[model samples]
Target: MTTTRRPGAYHCGIDAAMDVIGGKWKVLILWALDERARRFGELRRLLPGITEKVLASHLRELETAKIVRREEFEEVPPRVEYSLTPRGVALNEALAPLGAWGREHVIGGTAVTPGG
Candidate 1:
Protein backbone atom coordinates (compact mmCIF):
# COMPACT_ATOMS: atom_id res chain seq x y z
CA MET A 1 0.00 0.00 0.00
CA THR A 2 1.13 3.49 -0.79
CA THR A 3 0.57 6.54 1.40
CA THR A 4 0.30 10.00 -0.05
CA ARG A 5 1.57 12.75 2.18
CA ARG A 6 -1.05 15.38 2.78
CA PRO A 7 -0.14 19.02 2.64
CA GLY A 8 1.27 20.12 6.00
CA ALA A 9 0.57 16.68 7.33
CA TYR A 10 3.72 16.51 9.41
CA HIS A 11 4.39 19.83 11.05
CA CYS A 12 6.91 18.60 13.58
CA GLY A 13 9.54 15.95 14.23
CA ILE A 14 7.18 13.90 16.42
CA ASP A 15 4.64 13.78 13.62
CA ALA A 16 7.27 12.51 11.21
CA ALA A 17 8.49 9.96 13.72
CA MET A 18 4.99 8.74 14.41
CA ASP A 19 4.35 8.38 10.69
CA VAL A 20 7.12 5.78 10.50
CA ILE A 21 6.21 3.82 13.62
CA GLY A 22 2.51 4.55 13.96
CA GLY A 23 0.94 1.11 13.85
CA LYS A 24 0.45 -1.32 16.71
CA TRP A 25 2.85 -3.97 15.34
CA LYS A 26 5.70 -1.93 13.90
CA VAL A 27 7.34 -1.10 17.21
CA LEU A 28 6.96 -4.66 18.45
CA ILE A 29 8.51 -5.92 15.22
CA LEU A 30 11.38 -3.51 15.67
CA TRP A 31 11.83 -4.65 19.27
CA ALA A 32 11.97 -8.28 18.20
CA LEU A 33 14.61 -7.53 15.58
CA ASP A 34 16.69 -5.36 17.93
CA GLU A 35 19.07 -7.99 19.23
CA ARG A 36 19.88 -9.96 16.11
CA ALA A 37 18.77 -10.94 12.66
CA ARG A 38 15.77 -13.24 12.33
CA ARG A 39 14.13 -15.24 9.56
CA PHE A 40 10.48 -14.77 8.66
CA GLY A 41 9.48 -17.90 10.54
CA GLU A 42 11.56 -16.88 13.51
CA LEU A 43 9.84 -13.51 13.65
CA ARG A 44 6.47 -15.22 13.47
CA ARG A 45 7.46 -17.42 16.40
CA LEU A 46 8.79 -14.53 18.42
CA LEU A 47 5.71 -12.39 17.93
CA PRO A 48 3.03 -14.85 18.95
CA GLY A 49 -0.13 -12.78 18.39
CA ILE A 50 0.87 -11.28 15.03
CA THR A 51 -0.55 -12.86 11.90
CA GLU A 52 1.82 -13.83 9.07
CA LYS A 53 0.29 -11.27 6.72
CA VAL A 54 0.74 -8.40 9.17
CA LEU A 55 4.30 -9.44 9.91
CA ALA A 56 5.22 -9.52 6.26
CA SER A 57 3.59 -6.15 5.65
CA HIS A 58 5.34 -4.50 8.60
CA LEU A 59 8.68 -5.95 7.51
CA ARG A 60 8.27 -4.63 4.00
CA GLU A 61 7.43 -1.20 5.37
CA LEU A 62 10.42 -1.25 7.68
CA GLU A 63 12.66 -2.31 4.81
CA THR A 64 11.27 0.50 2.69
CA ALA A 65 11.94 2.96 5.51
CA LYS A 66 15.55 1.73 5.72
CA ILE A 67 14.97 0.72 9.33
CA VAL A 68 15.33 -3.00 8.61
CA ARG A 69 17.82 -4.72 6.37
CA ARG A 70 16.71 -7.84 4.51
CA GLU A 71 19.46 -10.13 3.33
CA GLU A 72 18.82 -12.92 0.91
CA PHE A 73 21.33 -15.72 0.59
CA GLU A 74 21.84 -17.96 -2.43
CA GLU A 75 21.72 -21.59 -1.44
CA VAL A 76 20.01 -24.84 -2.30
CA PRO A 77 17.21 -23.63 -0.08
CA PRO A 78 16.83 -19.91 -0.15
CA ARG A 79 17.51 -18.10 3.12
CA VAL A 80 16.37 -14.64 4.16
CA GLU A 81 17.01 -12.73 7.34
CA TYR A 82 15.95 -9.37 8.74
CA SER A 83 18.04 -7.22 11.00
CA LEU A 84 17.86 -3.70 12.37
CA THR A 85 19.75 -0.96 10.61
CA PRO A 86 21.47 1.87 12.48
CA ARG A 87 18.31 3.97 12.27
CA GLY A 88 16.30 1.14 13.75
CA VAL A 89 18.72 0.74 16.60
CA ALA A 90 18.37 4.42 17.31
CA LEU A 91 14.60 4.11 17.18
CA ASN A 92 14.74 1.29 19.72
CA GLU A 93 16.77 3.48 21.98
CA ALA A 94 14.33 6.33 21.52
CA LEU A 95 11.42 4.12 22.48
CA ALA A 96 13.05 2.87 25.65
CA PRO A 97 11.64 5.65 27.80
CA LEU A 98 8.16 5.05 26.47
CA GLY A 99 8.44 1.35 27.21
CA ALA A 100 9.56 2.13 30.73
CA TRP A 101 6.65 4.50 31.19
CA GLY A 102 4.23 1.86 29.97
CA ARG A 103 5.67 -0.71 32.32
CA GLU A 104 5.64 1.61 35.27
CA HIS A 105 2.30 3.34 34.81
CA VAL A 106 0.23 1.16 32.52
CA ILE A 107 1.36 -2.32 33.47
CA GLY A 108 1.59 -1.52 37.13
CA GLY A 109 -1.84 0.04 37.19
CA THR A 110 -4.97 -2.07 37.49
CA ALA A 111 -6.71 -0.25 34.65
CA VAL A 112 -4.82 -2.06 31.88
CA THR A 113 -5.01 -5.81 31.54
CA PRO A 114 -1.94 -7.84 30.76
CA GLY A 115 -1.91 -10.35 27.93
CA GLY A 116 0.16 -13.25 26.71
Candidate 2:
Protein backbone atom coordinates (compact mmCIF):
# COMPACT_ATOMS: atom_id res chain seq x y z
CA MET A 1 0.00 0.00 0.00
CA THR A 2 1.21 3.47 -0.87
CA THR A 3 1.31 5.97 1.97
CA THR A 4 0.33 9.46 1.06
CA ARG A 5 2.48 11.73 3.19
CA ARG A 6 0.42 14.82 3.58
CA PRO A 7 2.07 18.12 4.44
CA GLY A 8 0.65 19.76 7.55
CA ALA A 9 1.53 21.54 10.75
CA TYR A 10 2.08 19.11 13.59
CA HIS A 11 3.95 21.47 15.89
CA CYS A 12 4.95 19.01 18.59
CA GLY A 13 5.10 15.40 19.65
CA ILE A 14 1.62 15.55 21.14
CA ASP A 15 0.25 16.92 17.90
CA ALA A 16 2.08 14.31 15.83
CA ALA A 17 0.89 11.56 18.13
CA MET A 18 -2.67 12.84 17.98
CA ASP A 19 -2.44 12.92 14.20
CA VAL A 20 -1.78 9.21 14.24
CA ILE A 21 -4.35 8.14 16.82
CA GLY A 22 -7.03 10.79 16.33
CA GLY A 23 -9.79 8.86 14.61
CA LYS A 24 -13.22 7.60 15.58
CA TRP A 25 -12.27 4.03 16.40
CA LYS A 26 -8.55 4.35 17.11
CA VAL A 27 -8.90 5.52 20.74
CA LEU A 28 -11.41 2.75 21.42
CA ILE A 29 -8.97 0.25 19.99
CA LEU A 30 -6.22 1.74 22.13
CA TRP A 31 -8.43 1.53 25.20
CA ALA A 32 -9.02 -2.14 24.45
CA LEU A 33 -5.31 -2.73 24.08
CA ASP A 34 -4.79 -0.87 27.34
CA GLU A 35 -6.31 -3.93 29.00
CA ARG A 36 -4.05 -6.57 27.38
CA ALA A 37 -2.58 -7.84 24.17
CA ARG A 38 -5.20 -9.42 21.95
CA ARG A 39 -5.48 -11.12 18.62
CA PHE A 40 -7.44 -9.63 15.75
CA GLY A 41 -10.38 -11.90 16.42
CA GLU A 42 -10.31 -11.08 20.12
CA LEU A 43 -10.31 -7.40 19.39
CA ARG A 44 -13.19 -7.89 16.99
CA ARG A 45 -15.08 -9.72 19.70
CA LEU A 46 -14.46 -6.94 22.20
CA LEU A 47 -15.62 -4.29 19.76
CA PRO A 48 -18.73 -5.70 18.22
CA GLY A 49 -20.10 -4.15 14.98
CA ILE A 50 -16.75 -2.89 13.67
CA THR A 51 -16.17 -4.10 10.13
CA GLU A 52 -13.19 -6.33 9.58
CA LYS A 53 -11.93 -4.09 6.82
CA VAL A 54 -11.93 -1.00 9.03
CA LEU A 55 -10.22 -2.80 11.87
CA ALA A 56 -7.60 -4.16 9.53
CA SER A 57 -7.03 -0.74 8.07
CA HIS A 58 -6.74 0.96 11.48
CA LEU A 59 -4.41 -1.76 12.73
CA ARG A 60 -2.20 -1.20 9.75
CA GLU A 61 -2.22 2.54 10.35
CA LEU A 62 -1.37 2.15 14.03
CA GLU A 63 1.35 -0.31 13.17
CA THR A 64 2.77 2.07 10.62
CA ALA A 65 2.73 4.91 13.11
CA LYS A 66 4.67 2.79 15.65
CA ILE A 67 1.98 3.21 18.29
CA VAL A 68 1.13 -0.48 18.15
CA ARG A 69 3.25 -3.55 17.61
CA ARG A 70 2.16 -6.55 15.55
CA GLU A 71 3.70 -9.74 16.78
CA GLU A 72 3.45 -12.86 14.65
CA PHE A 73 4.07 -16.30 16.09
CA GLU A 74 5.49 -18.97 13.85
CA GLU A 75 3.28 -21.77 15.05
CA VAL A 76 1.50 -24.46 12.99
CA PRO A 77 -0.89 -21.75 11.97
CA PRO A 78 0.64 -18.32 12.29
CA ARG A 79 -0.99 -16.25 14.97
CA VAL A 80 -0.74 -12.49 15.30
CA GLU A 81 -1.41 -10.16 18.22
CA TYR A 82 -1.49 -6.42 18.69
CA SER A 83 -0.28 -4.43 21.68
CA LEU A 84 0.40 -0.81 22.41
CA THR A 85 3.94 0.53 22.32
CA PRO A 86 5.44 2.58 25.17
CA ARG A 87 4.45 5.73 23.39
CA GLY A 88 0.94 4.48 22.95
CA VAL A 89 0.75 3.60 26.61
CA ALA A 90 1.83 7.09 27.52
CA LEU A 91 -0.76 8.50 25.18
CA ASN A 92 -3.44 6.39 26.83
CA GLU A 93 -2.38 7.64 30.24
CA ALA A 94 -2.61 11.20 29.04
CA LEU A 95 -6.05 10.59 27.63
CA ALA A 96 -7.39 9.08 30.84
CA PRO A 97 -8.20 12.47 32.37
CA LEU A 98 -9.84 13.64 29.18
CA GLY A 99 -11.89 10.50 29.08
CA ALA A 100 -12.88 11.03 32.68
CA TRP A 101 -13.81 14.60 31.96
CA GLY A 102 -15.87 13.60 28.98
CA ARG A 103 -17.68 10.86 30.82
CA GLU A 104 -18.49 13.20 33.70
CA HIS A 105 -19.39 16.28 31.70
CA VAL A 106 -20.43 14.96 28.32
CA ILE A 107 -22.10 11.70 29.24
CA GLY A 108 -23.37 12.08 32.77
CA GLY A 109 -23.26 15.84 33.23
CA THR A 110 -21.97 15.47 36.76
CA ALA A 111 -18.78 15.41 38.76
CA VAL A 112 -16.48 12.47 38.09
CA THR A 113 -16.32 9.71 40.62
CA PRO A 114 -12.83 8.73 41.58
CA GLY A 115 -12.00 5.27 40.22
CA GLY A 116 -15.64 4.70 39.45
Candidate 3:
Protein backbone atom coordinates (compact mmCIF):
# COMPACT_ATOMS: atom_id res chain seq x y z
CA MET A 1 0.00 0.00 0.00
CA THR A 2 1.37 3.35 -1.06
CA THR A 3 0.74 6.34 1.18
CA THR A 4 0.71 9.87 -0.07
CA ARG A 5 2.63 12.52 1.81
CA ARG A 6 0.83 15.73 2.53
CA PRO A 7 2.68 19.04 2.51
CA GLY A 8 3.78 20.30 5.92
CA ALA A 9 2.54 17.07 7.48
CA TYR A 10 5.15 16.35 10.06
CA HIS A 11 2.86 13.96 11.90
CA CYS A 12 0.77 11.86 9.57
CA GLY A 13 -0.91 9.22 11.65
CA ILE A 14 0.19 6.31 9.48
CA ASP A 15 3.74 7.57 9.13
CA ALA A 16 3.98 8.62 12.73
CA ALA A 17 2.57 5.32 13.89
CA MET A 18 5.04 3.35 11.83
CA ASP A 19 7.92 5.55 12.93
CA VAL A 20 7.01 5.16 16.58
CA ILE A 21 6.57 1.40 16.66
CA GLY A 22 8.33 0.09 13.60
CA GLY A 23 10.67 -2.93 13.61
CA LYS A 24 10.56 -6.32 15.32
CA TRP A 25 11.84 -5.30 18.71
CA LYS A 26 9.36 -2.51 19.35
CA VAL A 27 6.27 -4.68 19.08
CA LEU A 28 7.85 -7.29 21.31
CA ILE A 29 8.66 -4.60 23.80
CA LEU A 30 5.07 -3.39 23.69
CA TRP A 31 3.79 -6.91 24.10
CA ALA A 32 6.00 -7.50 27.11
CA LEU A 33 4.83 -4.33 28.77
CA ASP A 34 1.15 -4.79 27.91
CA GLU A 35 0.06 -6.48 31.12
CA ARG A 36 2.25 -4.73 33.65
CA ALA A 37 5.04 -2.24 33.98
CA ARG A 38 8.57 -3.64 34.02
CA ARG A 39 12.01 -2.41 34.86
CA PHE A 40 14.78 -2.12 32.25
CA GLY A 41 16.44 -5.30 33.48
CA GLU A 42 13.12 -7.13 33.40
CA LEU A 43 12.53 -6.13 29.79
CA ARG A 44 15.99 -7.31 28.84
CA ARG A 45 15.35 -10.68 30.43
CA LEU A 46 11.91 -11.00 28.84
CA LEU A 47 13.42 -10.35 25.42
CA PRO A 48 16.57 -12.43 25.61
CA GLY A 49 18.17 -11.61 22.23
CA ILE A 50 17.96 -7.81 22.54
CA THR A 51 21.01 -5.87 23.65
CA GLU A 52 20.74 -3.23 26.34
CA LYS A 53 21.58 -0.42 23.93
CA VAL A 54 18.98 -1.48 21.37
CA LEU A 55 16.32 -1.89 24.04
CA ALA A 56 17.13 1.53 25.46
CA SER A 57 16.83 3.12 22.05
CA HIS A 58 13.51 1.42 21.34
CA LEU A 59 12.19 2.43 24.75
CA ARG A 60 13.18 6.02 24.16
CA GLU A 61 11.46 6.02 20.80
CA LEU A 62 8.27 4.58 22.27
CA GLU A 63 8.34 7.05 25.13
CA THR A 64 8.83 9.91 22.70
CA ALA A 65 5.92 8.66 20.64
CA LYS A 66 3.74 8.84 23.76
CA ILE A 67 3.03 5.14 23.53
CA VAL A 68 5.13 4.21 26.52
CA ARG A 69 5.55 6.10 29.76
CA ARG A 70 8.66 5.86 31.88
CA GLU A 71 8.57 6.44 35.58
CA GLU A 72 11.68 6.95 37.69
CA PHE A 73 11.88 6.61 41.46
CA GLU A 74 14.73 8.33 43.25
CA GLU A 75 16.45 6.46 46.02
CA VAL A 76 20.00 5.37 46.86
CA PRO A 77 19.72 3.45 43.59
CA PRO A 78 17.31 4.94 41.10
CA ARG A 79 14.47 2.75 39.84
CA VAL A 80 12.71 3.01 36.51
CA GLU A 81 9.61 1.29 35.14
CA TYR A 82 7.98 1.26 31.72
CA SER A 83 4.29 0.90 30.93
CA LEU A 84 1.97 1.41 27.99
CA THR A 85 0.01 4.59 27.62
CA PRO A 86 -3.69 4.53 26.65
CA ARG A 87 -2.69 4.85 23.01
CA GLY A 88 -0.31 1.96 23.34
CA VAL A 89 -2.96 -0.15 24.99
CA ALA A 90 -5.36 0.55 22.14
CA LEU A 91 -2.72 -0.38 19.59
CA ASN A 92 -1.99 -3.52 21.53
CA GLU A 93 -5.67 -4.44 21.42
CA ALA A 94 -5.71 -3.95 17.66
CA LEU A 95 -2.62 -6.11 17.21
CA ALA A 96 -3.73 -8.93 19.49
CA PRO A 97 -5.56 -10.92 16.84
CA LEU A 98 -2.71 -10.53 14.40
CA GLY A 99 -0.33 -11.86 17.02
CA ALA A 100 -2.57 -14.82 17.75
CA TRP A 101 -2.89 -15.56 14.04
CA GLY A 102 0.85 -15.44 13.58
CA ARG A 103 1.39 -17.80 16.46
CA GLU A 104 -1.25 -20.24 15.28
CA HIS A 105 -0.80 -20.29 11.52
CA VAL A 106 2.62 -18.85 10.79
CA ILE A 107 4.57 -20.35 13.65
CA GLY A 108 2.50 -23.45 14.29
CA GLY A 109 2.35 -24.43 10.60
CA THR A 110 -1.40 -24.38 10.36
CA ALA A 111 -3.65 -22.70 7.85
CA VAL A 112 -4.80 -19.24 8.79
CA THR A 113 -8.43 -18.93 9.73
CA PRO A 114 -10.64 -16.91 7.42
CA GLY A 115 -10.84 -13.20 8.17
CA GLY A 116 -7.96 -13.38 10.63
lDDT by residue for model 2 (1-116), tens: 32343447667777766677776789989999998899999999989888898899989988887879999999988899999999889888988998988888867966556787
| TM-score, cand. 3 vs. native | 0.78
In model 2, the clashing pairs are none
- Candidates, ranked, TM-score: 1, 2, 3
71-96 per-residue lDDT for model 3 (tens digits): 99987688999999999999899788
Q: Give the higher-lDDT candidate: 1 or 2.
A: 1
Strongest candidate by lDDT = 1
Global lDDT of each candidate: 0.87, 0.85, 0.85
Q: Which pairs of residues collide in candidate 1?
A: none
lDDT, candidate 1, 1-116, per-residue tens:
44343447788988888888888889999999988999999999998999998898889888888899999999879999999999999999999999999889877764475662
- Candidate 1 regions with alpha-carbon error over 4 angstroms: 1-8, 109-111, 114-116
Indicate the worst ten consecutive residues by lDDT in candidate 2: 1-10
Query: Candidate 2, after superposition: displacement of residue 92 in Å?
Result: 0.6
Judged by TM-score relative to the true structure, which candidate is superior, 1 or 2?
1
